[model samples]
Target: MLTELHIRHFAIVKSLDIEFRNGMTAITGETGAGKSIALDALSLCLGSRADASLVRPGCDKAEITACFAVAKDSPAARWLAEQDLDAEDECVLRRIINKDGRSKAWINGSPVPLAQQKSLAPLLVNIHGQHEHQLLTRDEHQLHLLDQFARHNHLLEATKAHYRQWADTEKQYRQQQQAKADREAQRQLLEYQVGELDEFALAEGEFEQLEADHKRLSNHRSLDEASLFALNALYEGEHNNANGLVQSAGQRLQESVDMDPQLGSINELLKQAMVHIEEAALELRHYQDQMHIDSAELETIEQRMTQALKLAKKHQCSAAELYPLHQQLKSELQTLIATDEASEQLAEQRQTLRQAYREQAKKLFDSRQRAANQLSDKITSAMQQLNMPHGRFEISVDHDNQAPATAKGTDQVQFLVSANPGQPLQPISKVASGGELSRISLAIQVMSATQQTVPTMMFDEVDVGVSGPTAAVVGSMLRELGGQCQIICVTHLPQVAAKAHQQLQVAKHTDGKETQTDVRALNNDERVVELARLLGGDKVTDLTKANAKELLAS
Candidate 1:
């Protein structure tokens, strides 16, 4: 319930602080006595769109703060917990709007976005007035009310989950099908790619080796000529060969060594030279053997190397990457095949989920239809008590053909009413006058209040169109509702005011040239006088006061 409200520099309200009590609290004053100002300030705290024009003429900013003490299990507290804000026995919402067209909001002194503040506002309070009659006028809201009345939140949640799954599956199925269809045009290219890569079958390190071998083989005749010339030079014909020359030198040195001691060192050096020349001659012969080249084998190597290069270019990769590319393509092909199976499986799962959703939706629709009827009947009865005795009301639950097959079991709910006897029942928005609609709106709210979980419900002049016995019944209904939840009503009806547990009289006082609104809680005597004023107008005669006292006593 709203515990307090503080407003500053907002519209006609310069500064005001009022503490509200539980149960029915009435705010009454003359038409322009700022009764609606208080409600407007409360609306500001609830995150309503702010305008710089709402600020006092001479002030830089306007501010409003509302304090609520909610039960631990109340939805407001639960909402606060979800927002990670302070939900401790009390919650405070504050909003400030600067003259520069900027606004800021806070929840429990913690800064928050306006949207979050708005979401939490409904949990704490419901301010129903002429504008909100649209809620009762809409079919979707009727369905929502029915769902709320039935407390089918768990089943509704299950339905939503099923919806999400069904939607996700449908999206996935479409995407996969589209992808498969698009891939059709690329199928020939993909297969050709796989086949071309497979044919080359290039081996690692083969390219570099082949290039070197090709160069050598391409100059095979020249290489043979060079090897033969080298061999001839190293171990030339018979007597001119390097080995024969070295042996001759060694034999001459050995004969000299027998004649002179210096010849001994010369003979050792000659023997070493002879050994090196013979080794060189053997290496030349080995080189000649290795130079043997076959033209046919060389052609085969060249052709394979050229094909490998061509395949690398066609695939936009190097020859070494061709093997890995083949593996990648094969793996992708395998995945495509597996996706076909998985898609079929998902389709089956989707069908199963769709069936479950259908069952749940049908159950939900049936429950709403029943709840709607009950709600309609209850509201109609209450409307008769509110003085529209001839008002005919109906809760129209019509089937909607435009609803998707997957929709929550195809029911479109609407509220219809007729304010006059024998008149055709029309949609609530069409058949009800403004004031008649006001009472009907109040009746609808009063009927739903017992089932709604909100802690506080405010009705701005709910008795606007009601009088006499109807006003008395409206007062009784409010009093009864106040016992269950906090109720605040702004009304000109003395009957309604007389039944309130507490009455806060709003009066305007002039300080010099400025008029300010002040709210005072009325005591028993004051309540009688205020009620008398509402009943008897400016002339609160002794008889009228006595009558007011009698009304209060009753």
Candidate 2:
């Protein structure tokens, strides 16, 4: 329920603040008195598209704020929480339009994008324009409105779920078919690459080990000569060589062992060192004797190393990475083969899902038919009170089992009407004039709104062509609806305005220098005067005042 609305520099409204109530509130004024300005201001905060032109002629910007008292578990509250903008049980939506046409929206004092404001609007308020009856002629909207009124959420949700399953399966099937040729091409590429890598049979660290072997073979003669020189110098040197020096040290230590007991330990250490030096000298000599190079083996090693480097460059990888790359390619090949195996199973799954979609759609079609009948009767009965004495309203559903399923279901729904006797029922859009449509729209909205979860409903100029007893009937209908939710009605009929629990009178005040629009909540006597002006003219007679009082009493 909307608790308060504030408008500043919006259209002709310089500054206006009004508190709203839970039941019906009527807004009325003479022509050019800014009667619709309040509704327009509320709409801005409700996410209607904004323009800078809406700003009061001399003002720099226009701003509107609407505060709603929301239920904890309502959709509006849930949306606010989802957006992280909840403020206890109150939700405030604000919009600002600058002179340069820039607009900003906010929820709970936090800035939000325009799209978010638009999304939350419907959940908070449903505004029906004078021409919204034309929307009833569209199939989907008709179907949707009927569904809302019928409260067939279970069937609708089940159908939607089944439709999603079918759609996903179909999408998958089409993608697989489209990719068949491409997958085949990829398969051939994978096979060729995998075969090449398998034949080469690369291993981890193989590149480094092979390079070491190649270097050793390529310089075999130089290594052999160097080892021999070192062996001869260390083992066969006549003086100052390693083996000779070690022997001399050991003998000296042995000579001193008798004088000092510590010298005996040093003497044994010298003996062990000399033995180790001798063993090293012999090993070097053996190495020199065994050293030899095979040119053919060296050539083979060079060729193998060159081939590995070339393959690495060809695959855009390091020599050591070749093995891992080969493994990855093989894994992908196996997955492709598995996809081939799964294709047959996916076809079967698609068929099963398609059948499920059809069955659910059938159920939805049957439910819609039943809902349409009930909805038509309700609205048709409502139409009679709104001045359409012979008006007949209907919801027509044409179910096509063969029609390709849409997300909504397989039935085409439309509203039909016959405003006069023997007129022959026609599509509502063709049969109803602007006035007739307004009343019919009122009836439909009243019927639909009773079943809606939204807490606020606003009707702009809904009583356009209605007057006399018919206007009272429309007023009564709105009043009845107000029992269930808050209603804000912009009307011209005094009878309609008189029936409201609250009356707001819109008036334009002008001086030679400035002009402004003001809206004030009318008290009991003030309401009677406003109604008298509506019933009479610029000058209200005593009779009109009495009639106004009588209207209010009714």
Candidate 3:
């Protein structure tokens, strides 16, 4: 339920704060007293369009804040939790509209997009505008009303999901059918590329090793000559070679070792140098033995390298990248093959989805048919209480089995009405007068309200064309609705105002320079005066006061 509304510099409201309770509230004032200003401000908090004109003259901005006490398991609470904006059982919606026409919204102190506010508004409050009866003429609106009255949210959601699945599968099937020739061409190209790469069979790291081997083979003669010369200089020379020179030096140092201790250290260094020289000589001899040039191996290595380069150039890659490219082409070929398989299965998939969608749509149609009957009966009964005793209301639920599937199913809902006895039922839009439309709209709203989960319902002059004892009856119906949830009505009828558990009077105040509208809760005595004003005119006579009291008493 809406607990409070705060408005500042909104239109002519200037600044006003109004507290609400868990019952019917009647808001009334003189014609130009701005009784609807509060409702307008509340609408802004509910994510209605905003404009610079909504700001009071000379004010920088307009602000509206609405506070509600939500039930733990209510739709509003669940939505807030889903958005991470829940503040226990309390929800606050705030909107600020600057004079430049830009606006911002917030929920639970966290800034939110205006769309979120719009999405959450219906779960918290249902506002029936003064002109709501105009919407009843549309077929879509009639269908929506019936579905809302049906209260089959899960069924509706399931039908929508099924429809989406069917539509998506059908689109995929059509696209695949159109692209069959193209896919087949692509598959052939991929297969050829993959086959060539597989035949090459390049291994990881093998390219670098092959290049090294090719270089060695190509320079075989130069390498063999260099190794032979090094071997002769180091060991094979026999005279003054490194090995003989170091051995003679060590023998001379050994002969002087007894004469001086320093000679012993020198002799040991000479011995180590001779050992290293011998090891070097042996390694050089072994390298010379291993050096040989084979023309046949060289030709074979050159041929393989040329083939690798040629293939790399053809594929627009280096030899090193040939392996990776081959793997990539194989993957693409596999994907195309899988797509072919999936396309072959699409017909069966689409058939299954189509059947599923039809099943859900049928279920939705059945539920709506049952709900239409119940709603028609209840609204017809309500019309009698609203002073239309001979009126008959019926909801026509026509299911078209041949129609293409839709998210809302294939049922065409139409409201039919007869205003007098022995008259045939006709489309309500074409038959009902303006006053009858107002009463019928009210009846429908009342019946729909009973099925809604929203805790607050506001009616802005929904009783516009109603008067006489019928107005009193309208008031009584609203009061009865208040027993289930909060009801706030912006009205001009004294009977409606008198029926409310609480009343608020909107008054306009003006100085020479400025004008502002103020809304205040009325005391019992104050309510009587306001009702008297509504009953009579600006001049409240004693008889009007008496009549107001009588209305209150009743």
Best candidate, TM-score: 1
For candidate 3, which ten residues in a row score worst on lDDT? Answer: 229-238
TM-score for predicted model 2 compared with the true structure: 0.76
Error of 2 at 136 (Å): 2.9
- The C-alpha stretches of model 1 lying farther than 4 A from their native spots are 205-210, 228-292, 302-353, 388-392, 398-402, 405-410, 418-426, 432-435
Which ten contiguous residues of candidate 2 have the minimum total lDDT? 230-239
What is the C-alpha lDDT profile of model 1 across 1-554, one tens digit per residue?
99999999887678899999999988888777878788888998888888889988789999999999978887788888887996689999999999987999999999999999889888898887745576776767777666666667777777787877878888898887878776655555667777776676665577778888999999989988887877786676555776677778888878787679798888888788877877887887888878777989899988988888788787898876766777788677667667778888988988897777777777777777777788888888998888888887778776543467544456777788888888888888785378888788778878877787788988888666678888889899999999998999988989888889999988877778777777779899999898889888988989889989988987
Native-referenced Cα lDDT, model 1: 0.82
TM-score of each: 0.83, 0.76, 0.76
Question: Which is the better candidate, 2 or 3, if ranked by TM-score?
Answer: 3
Mind giving the per-residue lDDT tens digits that candidate 3 earns over 250-305? 88878888888788888888888877777887887887778777888878777777
**Top-down lDDT ranking:** 3, 2, 1
lDDT of 3: 0.90
